[model samples]
Target: MKLLLLTAGSRGDVEPFAALARRAAASGHEVRLALPDRSGVDTTGIDARSLEADFSALIESQGVSPLAAMRSLRDVVRPVMRAVIVNAAQAALEFRPDVIAWHPKVLSAPLIADALGIPHVLVELVPVMTATREFPAAGTVTRSVGPLNRLTYRAAAGAGAMFRREVDEAAEVMGAPRSRRSSAPAATLLPISPAILPRPADWPESAVLTGAWRAREATTDAAAPTPDPALDAFLAAGPFAYAGFGSMAAGDPAARGRALVAAARARGIRLLVATGLGGIAVPDDARGDDVFVTRSVDHGVVLPRAVAAVHHGGIGTVQAATAAGTVSIVVPFIADQPFWGAMLHRRGLAPAPIPRRRVTADRLAEALAAAPAFQTAVEAAAARMADEDGAAEALGVLERLAGRPRNDALRHP
Candidate 1:
């Protein structure tokens, strides 16, 4: 089967699709990945194409403030999203895939697939679709608002509706008439650990809760990691804490880094900080003999060695920390982050989340002090999730969807 996978956004959004692409290729399917330019996701052993947008650069250049985002929505965000849709449509024409799987950001995939008479799958990293009372939609309220939880998903749907014009434009560019069809995917594949957030009872049968998509070689019984000698020495020094804010550039990064360093120092432990996407800036004054700062390090190599990880609550980071059996201290910046933090806390995996605005040295130190209480639960959850192969599960779903007869004349209901 020929599979075309489309995704946009930062490394977190792109990496999961890369994992799925690799798995599909390994399973004897032809896979092509279309993602943002310079996404930096390792897509070895797969045919990867570049979409025109660069979500990472966009985030880094413009801080994630609601006001700034709204101000630039028309001028910047729309054009970028339009470019992604057009590029994805172009790739679909070239690949002529049997199945199309896409991240939510690529809203044009379903229309392209419909035009091509193939199946399309929605690959959600978070449970934003498929409304349920289990929890509020991710990126909305972190805690449930009783019966109102189901309403939160409407906001996610509205977000997609905002790009309806782009979707229609993409269809025309693909030389297919504008599809008035609902554009709902044939299948929804969620690459989230059921152990972290179980499948909600209200989800449709078309949705499958696959475990977290991870590279088999990276997490499986592969050879021991060979981190840099400095990092290796730091881990050997003593129990250190890990801090990183992936792809979030909301506030003063230098101050945030200083707070993290001070908090770790207050706990009398060493610190290893990653300045990912420049959202964290470890000031020179804060860098002591006990503090190590790097632009990048393998989370798989470092998190397991840390006593606890202090990070922005990206689902990827959340999954990484949990899989390493490392407790977490989530300082959420924005969008689905607080949701993950609150869920982890509810599951006995971490302390209560600290909103990024509320983060301080004292608060972080307190969370660090509280970390040990959750270690046993974190380890147990990690053990349970160990048996999961999210990529394989998602590939299976795509294959099944591909086997179904094509709907060449799909129309909106």
Candidate 2:
């Protein structure tokens, strides 16, 4: 089968689908990843295809409050939605995929697939997309209430559907019948494990959590893929913490580095920071034998050995830290990040979330030292996560629609 994956957003959003593409290719299917823009992504094995626009540029690279980002993001979709659908539809024509797998935010894919009369799957990276009384909004740590929990779902879904107007335009683009919201994709795949996030009873039968879409080799042996001699020396130096905040730039980065170093000093631990696309600045003036800051480090290799991990509370980082049995300290910046931080805390995997605005050297130092006794449960969570094969499960869903190697792959147990 030939599968075309459509996605946009930061690296976290694109990577799950890329992982899925690799898994599908391994099973003898032709896979190509279609990006709104593929800049800065290592497309080595991604079977990469470009839709030719960067979402970050559309969204903004500077500090926009979460509410402002949400408002502007929705507005951008309204004006540019037609062009995006047309461009992605054109790209799909070039790939001529048998199936289209898309991230939920990439609204154009489903519309284009419907216009082309092809099956498409929605790949949701976070639980926010699902409506359920079992949980409240994905942007907040709201406790479940009678109908309020479900209302949050409705609001999120309804707001997202505002972009569906482009489907009417899609009809003219493909010269096909107008698409209907009632006719959603054939399936929805969630790349998170129930061990970490239990499946909500309110979620439709079509949606399934297949664990985090980690590579088979990664689950089996994380450190083997990208060994780092400098990281090895740092780890050997003493117990250290992993601090990574990917692509979430704000505030004085130089000061941010000094604060983290101070935090590590407060806790009497070494610190290793991954200066990811987040624009974190760790000046040499603040660096010493105990503080090591690198622009890149294979998180898969380092998270496992660290005593604890502190990140910007991306869902991907949460999953990685949990699977490595390391405790977490979430300093949320925006969007559903606060939700993940709260969830991890509620689940006993971390302390209360520290909002990016409240992040200080003293606060982080205390958090690193005051972490709960969550090692046993987190270790258990890791074992359960390792047992799940998210990519294989998602592939099974696709094959069922394509009628290739089909079986009882949908049963959650």
Candidate 3:
């Protein structure tokens, strides 16, 4: 089977799909990943392609920050998203994929799948796409606020309309019927487990709650030369707190770094800070044998060894922390991060998330002290997750949806 996967956003958003693509390829399927040129996805085994756009210019115009770039692109390229969808559809027509799997935000892919008469699956890393009464994650305003919700719906409808217009234009260019585009029965796959979020009464039966698709990281060989002896020595010392905002860099990271340093000192924990995308400038005077600063490290490699993890609550970081069975102290900056943080708190896996605006040295210290208890909850959750095979489960669903016979007769019989 040929599978075409589409996604956009930061590395966190793209990495999971890449993992899934690898899995599908391993299962003897041809997989192609269609992502924005700026997504920075590692195209190792899969055929990774990009839409027609100057990604570097987009990045520069939006500022070097990935968060800023995403917001800017969303606002500036609202129309372009339609073009992207049409282009991806055309690509799929050429590839003749057996299935079209896309991220939730890639709304165009669904439309394309409709046009091509192929099965589509929506993969959601965050819980924002589905509104469920069971989960308090979706904002009340989207459910209530009649006028506001209507407006939001209208905006979404408008975007869809614009996308249709673009698809018609592309069809005209290709000498095809503009009105022939049709939608298909879609499935939504969520990375969260039912343990955290039970099947909601309002949720569609098509949506599946699969555990996170965590990528396996290659083990760093002991024979490999250490990149930094100082950082190496710091890791060799007692377990330290891991701090980084992932792709969301702070406007004033030095001040934030200072606060983190102070908080670590207050909590009597060593600190390893990631200077995100050149945003965090650790002061010269702040450097010490106890304080280690680096650009970044593989979260899979670092999180398990750490006493606790502190992050901006990005989904990838959260999943990495969870998979490592390490407690997390989430400080959400923006987007769906706050949602993840709150969910963690509700699961008793972390303390109440410290909002970025409310983050201070004292509050951070308090959260750090409370983090140890979360390890127990995290361990229990990891144990349950370990028993479930997310990749295999998702693939099974996909195969069934694609009209292929199930691998196991016992389950399907």
Candidate 4:
């Protein structure tokens, strides 16, 4: 099968597709991935291409009010997102994939697939699309609003509708009229562990809650040198707290780093701080032997050895911490982050969420002191996720779709 995978956003949004691509390729299927041009994504063994826009540049700093964030997303992010979707549509035409799987950000995929009469799957990092009474949409409210929970999904629908004109333009360029773009995706795959958040009964059967996708590390030649000796040494020294805010422009990273360092010092624990996408910065005065700062680290490699993981509550980081069986200390900044943090806390997997605005050295130290209490719940959740292979399950869906009669007319003559 020739599969085309498309996604847009930060590393968190792109990595899952990359993992799925690696798995599909390993299973002897041809795969192509289209995503934003960004560092920190592992595209080693898969065929990949860059979309036109660099979506990372549009990421707003944390602490913006919800209304302000929505306005900025409309004025700043939407244009870039539209461009990316168009680029993905063009890639689909060129690749003529037998099956398509795309992040929700790429609204053009469904139109393209409908026009070509091929199967397309929607890949959600969170439960934004499917309406459920169990909880409100991820970024809307941290708590459920009873029977009104189902109505919150209109926000996601409106978000996609905002790009309707652009999506139609892109599809029209590929000989797909607006009328032919009505078919729904073959499946909606949420690469989240059911253990952390059980599937709601209201979801359609087409929606599958596959566990978090973890990409395999590329095999390096024997002569290859170690990537980061300092990080390796830090892990070897003793158990430490892992702190990183991947791709979130946490406001005033330097100050945030200082607070984290102070908190670690207060608790008398070692700290491994990763300044991912400038979400956290290590101040000059705070650098010490007990504190190791790096641009990035493999969560799979480092988190398992750590005593706890501290992050901005991105679903990717949440799942990583869960899979590693490391208790979390979520310092949510914006959007769905707080929701994930609250969910973890409610499940007894972590201390109560500490919003970034409320984060202080004393508060962080308290959370760190309390982290050990959640270890049992964290380990039990990890055990539930241990046997899951989300990437493989997603690939199976694509394979089954590819077995159907293909639209040979859309292929090259």
TM-score of 4: 0.92
**Better lDDT candidate (1, 4):** 1
| CA lDDT, every model vs. true structure | 0.86, 0.74, 0.69, 0.83
Q: For model 2, what is the error of residue 198's alpha carbon versus the real structure, in angstroms, after optimal superposition?
A: 0.7
Per TM-score, the best of the predicted structures is 1
lDDT of 2 by residue, 277-394 (tens): 5536788888898988786666677888888888988888888889888889988877678888888878877888888877789999889887647777788888988778888999
Model 2: runs farther than 4 Å from truth? 38-41, 56-60, 67-84, 161-170, 177-182, 219-229, 403-413
**Residue pairs clashing, model 3:** none
Worst 10 residues of 2 by lDDT: 404-413
Report the lDDT tens digits of candidate 1 across residue range 1-413.
99999999888899888888888888899989998987767776779998989887678767877778788999888888998988999999999999899988988887788778788888888889778898999999987899999999888778877888898889888777775664567878999998798888888888899999987777522234545787777777778999988777877888888889899999998999988888789888878899999887788888888899999999988988999999999998888898999999998899999999988899999999999999999999999889999998888888888857555454432
lDDT of 2 at 100: 86
Backbone clash total, candidate 4: 0
TM-score of each: 0.96, 0.88, 0.83, 0.92
The C-alpha local distance difference test score for the whole of candidate 1 amounts to: 0.86
| Candidate 1 Cα outliers beyond 4 Å, as residue runs | 220-223, 406-413
Q: Which one is best on lDDT?
A: 1
Q: List the residue pairs that clash in candidate 4.
A: none
